[model samples]
Structure formats: structure tokens, C-alpha cells
Target: MFYWLLKYVVLGPVLKCLFRPDVTGLEHVPATGPVILACNHLSFSDSIFTPLIVKRKVTFVAKAEYFTGKGIKGWLMRQFFVGTGTIPVDRSGGKAARAALDTQLRVLLAGSIAGIYPEGTRSPDGRLYRGKTGVARLALESGAPVVPVALLNTDEIQPTGKLIPKIKRVRLRFGAPLDFCRYSGSVGDRFVERAVTDEIMYELMTLTGREYVDVYAASLKTSVEAPRPAAGAFEPLEDRAR
Candidate 1:
């Protein structure tokens, strides 16, 4: 109810008016049934604008901190995420990571759309980073088609640490759904999962036309102590990942 109200009546109108998102290839998304929207994470607004454009409700897993903060700001953040169809999960790996995967699997098996950022975290630079295998696991386990989605220019609208977004036109593209049913029984296989993850990342690279960085975005964040990448220091795709 709140989701509908926010999308159609309250926040949707305001966002549509301000950003005027230009979306394409929406027909690629199936009208019903479970599906995975594997997207490249560029900015915080990727979450906001994706649900706004897609007709069906998109369920995304956000870091647990977003739901566990203190004060009124925390309450507001929690409400916003919930209303936007986001659930909180501990992104810290190990048991917590498995739990998060289980949560999303439930959502998918229940015949709902699950939006996943395969890159694990937002790109520090504009370049697309290597994807995490969680998306592959979800697709293989759920047997849902994976749709490669690219949200262009969202970073400019709401870059990291920017409270207010600048008024900018957002563009979104949805590619044809990828079927990995060939690897149906290979969910737990690390090599198969890596291949699936790479395939999804390749589609994202083609869709967004961004440079491909084989390193995980989270690792780069730790090295620099921030999300900003050092200029001209990325590895060549052929020389690095291969």
C-alpha cells in the first residue's frame, strides 16, 4: 500500500518531474513470474530510479547498517528503504552472506522480482567492476531469467556522499533476459559460478559501454580509504582477469 502510494501518488510524481528518466527496452522484463535484474551499481540513486521505472516492485537487499542506525534520521532511512521494497541484510561475508542469499532466494521462489547488483558494491569509478557470484547462485537456484539492466548518468544525479541530487536526466536500458538453465545443477560449483558472473558482467559492459575492471569494487575502496578511484590506474581487462 505504501509502495503504491509512494510510486504513484507521493514520491513518484516528484521524481519523474525532477529527473525525467528516459528508459528503453522495458519490454524485455517479463510481465509476471520471478526474474533477476542484474545491474551495474554506479550510484546510490540506482536503487531509487530502478523501482520508479520498472512497473513491478523490485526487491533489493541493502546493507544492515541502513536499517540499524540511530535517531530520527535512521528511522527515516529505514522507512524509505522499506517503502522502496528494500530489505536489510548483513553484507559481511560468511554466515551473514549466506543468510542474505537465503532471504533473496525466498523472495524469488515466491515468484517475485529480485534486483541484484552483481558488482557487490557501487563502482568507485565509472568503470564496471567484476561481479560477485551471488547473482549467479540466485539465478541458478531459482531458475529465473537474468535481465541485464544499465542505469546511465545516475552517478551525476546522486554521487557518493551527496545529500541532495542535482537535477539531471536519467537513462535506463534493459537488455534481453539471459537464461542460464544450461547450468541448472551447477549452482554450488565455484568455476561455474565464476563463469556465470563473468557472463553477466560482460552483458553489463556491453550495455553501459563502461570500461571493465576485473577487481572487486570493494577492494579498491579499502585501498584508497574511499570510493574514489585514483586517476588512470585501472588494469586492462585482457591483462588482468585472464
Candidate 2:
């Protein structure tokens, strides 16, 4: 298939030879099992190099537009995402957000590793943002072990909005797997999900050592002239609910 071909034939060999990405704690990855590889999002290339360095296929929950785009560039992107085993997700959130979790569950139940960014989207600024409960919901619902992964120096290789990335050595660090079996049957409990999500964010923050911002990344993109919440008051995490 295109996935294996690209990995072993085309891009894989080139990436491995060029950057020779460094990885630590790789032994933490289970030899075989359904697990969640929760990673910090730094650059768009984080998606590419994250899986390239791992032994198992890491299915990322990418935006649907990558698969639905048009024209020659669209065709190439669609093929790349598909060949890389990336799942298209609607970032609209709410019911759509739950749907994305369901899709990830399907991948988990099949015993494949699902790669997810707890931040929900790439950080416009590099600081870490609060994680969404969907990751907690997925973890509890499927009972998969969560491995915190840190991808370093990828932003330098391919920064935001750049089409081509220069060759640069990168680091991929995998952390201890976290088990939330105590909260397994407690799905839909807002308190429990928030507790679990915060725990996951703490792990990511610890691994990456990035400053933690208590808000979603998208909210920071709003126009300065847009209606703003009162000082010291921000949208509740449950309002956006993804």
C-alpha cells in the first residue's frame, strides 16, 4: 500500500538519512497494544516526523480539509495524509468533537496506536495550552495507556506557514504510559474528565518544559476589536467542549 511504500521507499528513507532523529524512552512504547501517543504540537511537520520515527503506524486525527482539498496541491496532500494513515477530523467541536473521539476509538479497538495532540490544534505561539477533555474521554472510554511524547526542534525545521522545511536534527522523547483505569466507568463526568485532562497536560508540560497557558489556542487568534470577555474572565472549558 501507499503507506508502507512511502514509509519504506520514498519519504521514510530520506527523512531517516537526513535528520537521523534522536529518540529517548522508546522502550516505553509497548511492543503491541492499543495505546494513545499524546504529543505536544509545535509545527506542522510534527505530524510527519512523529510517526516516521516510531515503529508502529501512528494515526493522527488531522483536519478534514487535508483530505478534502482541491487541485494538484490538494491531490498530493490527500494522498500523503491517506498514505500516512492520518484520520480526518472535523474541528467544529461539540457533537463533531465527540464524533472525532468515536473515530479514534474505532482505531484503538482495532489495536492500533492513535496519535493525538491534547492541545487540539497547533499552538500559534509555542507555549503549551490547556488540553481538551476529548483526550481524557477517549482514554477512559477505550482504557488505552497514554504515552506522553515530546518532539523537539521541529519548529525550526518547518515553521508555521512554511511549505518547505530545511533538514535539521530533531529529538523525539517518549514518556511513561499513564493509566486512567480508575476513571474508566466515569466517562461523561465533567469533573472527572477535567481532572484527567489536567493530569495529562501536566505530564506534557513536564516533558516539554513549556509555559502553560490556561486557555485554548484558538481564542488567542480572535481580533483585538472582537467582543472580549471581562478581565480575569475567560470562556469556560466546557463551553467549547473539545
Candidate 3:
């Protein structure tokens, strides 16, 4: 398969030699069954570097734009994503978000590890931002254990808007699996959902040791002309509904 060929024959060996990533706590990942790997989004390379280190075939939900672009470059990008098992998800909210979550749920139900950036988008400032509750929703809905994965120094390799990655050392730390069994059957409640999401974010915070902001990453990057809500006031009722 293209995935193995790239990982073993092409990109994998080369990347390992170049970056010399320090991977820790990989044993925490379940060797089998469905698992959710919730990580902070620091850079575009987060997706690339994660699979290189994790032993399992981890799949992340990537933006649909990556697959829809035109031209030869776009064609290659789409091929690479598909080969790597990246699912295309529309990042737009409302029905699009629902559809994306449905795709993620399917991946989980298939008993494979699913990677998600709870922040919903890459962190423009490298600081950990408030996480969206979609991750919790997925875990609760799928009955999967969520593992908090902290990736250090990926931003240094390929920061926002950088086409090429600088050779740099990176560290990947995977925390123990977080159980949400207590919230089982209550996933529909907004309060319980937000509470569970907050708990997962707190664990991620402890693992990453990054400065936490109460705002979502996407909201912070919105254009100045866009109407802005009061800080922390944008928390949706569905977040608490479960």
C-alpha cells in the first residue's frame, strides 16, 4: 500500500533521520479497538509528524479544501491525503460540522484510532486554545477512550504559512487513556458534554504545559471586521447539552 511504502520506503526513514523526534508514552495508546487521540493543533506538520511516530495507523480529519483544490499540486495533495487515510471534513459549522462528526464516528466505529484537534484549527500563536466539544461528542457517541497527545516543537518545524519545514527536533508525548464512562448515556446533555470536554482539555493542558486561552482558535483568528462576541461568552448551549 502507498501508506506503508511512504512510511517505510520513502518519507518515514528520511523523516526519522532528519528530525530525530523524541516519542514518549506511545505505549499508552491501545494496541487495538477504537481510540480517540485528541491533540493540540500547533502547525500543519502536526498531522504529518504524528503518524510517523505512533505505531498504529492513525487517521485525522483533514479539511475538505485539501482534496478539492485544482491543478497538479492539488491533485498530488489529494492523493497524499487519501493514501495516508485522512478523511476530508468540512470545518464550517452547522450542518457541515455535523456531517464531519458523522464521518469521524464512522472511523471510530470501524475500530480504528482517530486523531482530532479539539481546537478545530491550527493555533496561530502556538498557545493552546479552548477546545471544541466535538471531540467529546465523538468519544461519548462512539464509546471510545480519548488519549491526550501533546506534541512539542512541531510549530518550530513548520509554522503557519511556511511551505517548507525546517529541520528541527520534536517531542511527542501521549498521555494515558481518559475514560468517559461516567458520562455514558448523558452525552445528549449540554452541561455534561461541556463538563466532559473541559475535563479532557484540562488533561491535555497538563500534558502539553501550554498557556490556555478560553477562546477557540478559529474565533481568535477571525478577521477584525467580523462581529466579535465577548470573551468566553460564545460558549454554545449545545456544548453544555452533551
Candidate rank order under lDDT: 1, 3, 2
lDDT for each residue of candidate 1 in 1-242, tens digit (9 for 90 to 100): 99999899999999999999888899999999999999988788898999899999999988888888799988988888988879777877899988888988999999999999998888877789989999999999999999999876677678777878889778788999999999989979999999999999999988887788898999998898544554234333432354
As a whole number from 0 to 100, the lDDT of residue 235 in candidate 1 is 33
Top of the candidates by lDDT? 1
For every model shown, what is its TM-score relative to the native structure?
Answer: 0.92, 0.89, 0.89
lDDT of 3: 0.83
Stretches of candidate 2 off by over 4 Å are 223-242
Worst 10 residues of 3 by lDDT: 227-236
Query: Clashing residue pairs in candidate 1, if any?
Result: none
Name the candidate that leads on TM-score. Answer: 1
- Please give the CA lDDT of all the candidate structures: 0.87, 0.83, 0.83
Residue 203 accuracy (lDDT) in model 2: 86
RMSD for each of the candidates: 4.9, 7.6, 7.7
lDDT of 2 by residue, 45-89 (tens): 899998898888889989998898899999999999999989888
Clashing pairs in 3: 189-241, 189-242, 190-240, 190-241, 190-242, 191-240, 191-241
